[model samples]
Target: MKTIRQVSMLQFTLMVSAFQISVAFLSLPRELARQAGTDGWIAIFFGWGMATLASAALVKVMKNNPDGTILDLLQRYMGVWASKIAAFIFTAYYLLLAYDGFMIATLVIKLWLLPSTYIYVLVLLLLIPTFQIAQHGFQAIGRYSEIVTLLSIWIPFVYLSTLRHAHWLYLLPVIKEGWLPVLSTIKIMVYPMLGIGLVFFLYPYLVRKDKALRAMVISNTLTCLVYLGITLVCYVYFSPDEIAEYNEPVISIMKSIEFQFIERVEVLFIAFYLFVFSCIWIPSMHLVSMNSAWLLGKGPERGHLALWCFAVAVSFFIYRPSFIDAARVNNFLNLAGFVMEFALPACLLLYVAIIRKVRGEKRS
Candidate 1:
């Protein structure tokens, strides 16, 4: 299993898009509206474009290294001890990301479906599948992302039902608030676009490395479309002034949907969204386990991974985060993630480019 072959580009896209779509489903529209009014979607596309450039830099780094993970590069550039320390830091980072997935899912589930349920139970449910999928390594996780994406494909079509009350006038005069607000919200947009950094670790497993850029662009485009469509639908359906009142704008849109047979479809949607949410954490757990395994100078350890997943989940419930606290934590994560997503990639690519140039000169 440690020596498994590379995944197809389609699987690659699904995996990447799945992570991008996860936590954003709940509060993204609301955050955008709060920050930039209807212009929030614009910032989403802009940040996505920026994320694409950052992603391309990462792909360039991977191509130069070829046959290696970031750890292998660290080993080359620094030494074995330094690489081990870097792997440990990355393991902690992946765990932090995994924790965010669990936190976001728990918060949304608690808000939408079971306000009274114990947070511990929700955390347990979220972590169980994370450990199960992370234990199987990337092969099972890739298939799971693709399969879950197929199953959840109908959700966007379901969102269209809310457009019956859509007021196109709400989106009129798109920049009613001025460009400053929209520019400020680009930071918020970068939050949903956070998954691009995972490509550093994922690129080595690509079946067609040359198609890596296309896979990334397509995946980012798909995620941008999803965010754009939902935000557009939300902007039209609710008055601009009232949109900020709802915390989870995308999920709230489902409230208007009442079928003759189905009383509250949003409940069903929120329940099934756990699958969408899983993509964020499962890959995160894999990264954590794989990085830790590398730190130990071995392959992934499912048992240790399982323990770390549970620890992350359990810590949240033990502390019992309030909604405001969660938001604060997310703000910190957003800042950290923005640096990792763009700045780190730009620096790494430059480093790799210089190293390769120096090596060529030595060979000449």
Candidate 2:
């Protein structure tokens, strides 16, 4: 079936925000502290600025063919053969993206919630809801994003409770070394802020295409605030040297909070985050299936979904990657996602501009 333009801007913004949150947020504080010390939070704003510009460029590319996906624009400006190649590359990227998210979620579950469960079993359980939502297409995906965002709204406030003994003095002397360190960490910020590029695929489905740029900016802003808030909280809550010691300072901070009514709130928090992290992979997996079907000259169907799901299940079951393995995948995604999310959009915008100019001149 043909896709429909039914996604509202609010749903789009929430979906984009969820995409940016990813597994990266879990260790974001450690990443910043290790790279830039206390001044690392500054890099988030810089990253947000860069992500916003990249998002704007993507919107402009979509504007060139407002009613079609990137695949359609590629075919129009490049050629059929070129579009297929581009689709294949995109398919690979999204597939890897899905795997990275899925693996991270499984790792977190094993570490905190389900240590004894088999990896393949967890993969299968995760895929069930993912397939159900994704098979229905982008509209269902958009609504799922909206629902998850609303449900997760209170999570940030829970973080605030960790600040009872926070040492505001820990954040003293901004840029302790120099701008060099803070500026250097901006590259580390790239991977987490990447969900904006989904605009390339999501633009055509936007109901208010005129406000696509606005939605992109707002979503990036929301993501930035979440990253910034949590990073700053971790910085003040833990010593600069101590922050990097914990792989996930956000979850570690929860250990400080004690309640008579509850034990191990961090465990509950991690379990709840299973649902939050689902936001990352489900949409990506759907995109994988969608692009795969497009390459085969078929509309999205359950067959493509089943094929990719089986592949993911089998691969993880065989590999059974350890924590180090998952980290390596994340590292690879950091580099690959930068190429796809940041570098490619800028190149495509320039190429599309030149192509349009030449075509206009030819018509004249």
Candidate 3:
């Protein structure tokens, strides 16, 4: 019997959007401020364009072989050895992405909400839910992402509240330093936009295969709007000089919002973010396991999922990394993502086009 492809286009799009809006979104305002000052929000548009182009290229690559994942394409067009290497690289990339999400969530939780909680305990807590979601495969992950996206709709509205005190003048003097800084900040926009790479594995599972590109574009558009809206709110709410001072200006600005019932909304906001943040590691862990299994020529076994969870937990325990270490890992992960997510698809598309043309000519 053939494996049924159960993920629908809507679920696939939500999964992509959820993956893009990750732990990085929390600190995005600060990074933008440091890189582009008040004009930082403009960079998101340029980032959106870049992300769209990359997604288009990725879509074309998948279109050439709609039934196969990247691993299958690589093995067919490249070779078994090359495909194995690609699989290994993908597994590592997904593992690092998962680890970064896990570490950042743990650190954020420990620092803001649970100061006394042991790191191992937090790691295991995070892993349990992730393992549960990932073991069920793409259908479950897509459904979970759709549910999380629907439930978390209130988050952006909460951010909208901070605009009451917004100083629109702060956004004035736009491009005060010319366009170079704003353009340069486009690079900083990449990490937060990294999650769209989920399409590499998910394209084969999409129910409406022809609409995959449209779904990806919609996903990137949603992500761009969210990032742009929040960054603009931050820019106007906080002074040019003050915005860069906070580690996470998006969360920090929430302190100004006052309500009768809730005393510390930011605390609750941070805690609830755990749900949004889980979207990252959960899908990421599944990607890691899926790619690793493909690398080993194995079926989708739940045993592989359990083993990876144990490995991740042991790695965290062995190192017991601090916030600084997590920051370093984030940096490395961003660099790897540029190559794996952004560059690799474009390269594959070029290779596939050329090879197909040559083969067609020989047949003629």
**Predicted structure 3: clash tally:** 0
How well does candidate 3 score on lDDT at residue 185?
90
For residues 259-327, write the lDDT of model 3, one tens digit per residue.
899999989988888888998999888888887887787766577789999999998788777878877
Q: For each candidate, give its TM-score against the true structure.
A: 0.95, 0.97, 0.97
Question: Which ranges in model 1 have alpha carbons more than 4 Å from their true place?
Answer: 298-300, 361-364
Per-residue lDDT value at 43 in model 1: 91
lDDT of 2 by residue, 1-364 (tens): 2647489999999999998896888998898889999999999999999999899888887888888889998998999988899889989998998998888888888887889999889999999999998887778888998888888888888889888878999998877799999998989988898788788888888898999999889999999999999999999999988999997888999898777989898998888888789888888888898788888987545789889999999998888878798788878888998899899989998898898788784321
**Decoy 2 TM-score against native:** 0.97
**Cα lDDT for residue 360, candidate 2:** 80
Q: In model 2, which regions exceed 4 Å deviation? A: 1-5, 361-364
Report the C-alpha lDDT of model 1 over 176-286, residue by residue, as the tens digit.
889999999888877788888878788788889899999999999999988888989999998988989998878778889988988999999989998999998899988
What's the true lDDT of residue 363 in model 2? 22
For candidate 3, give the lDDT: 0.86
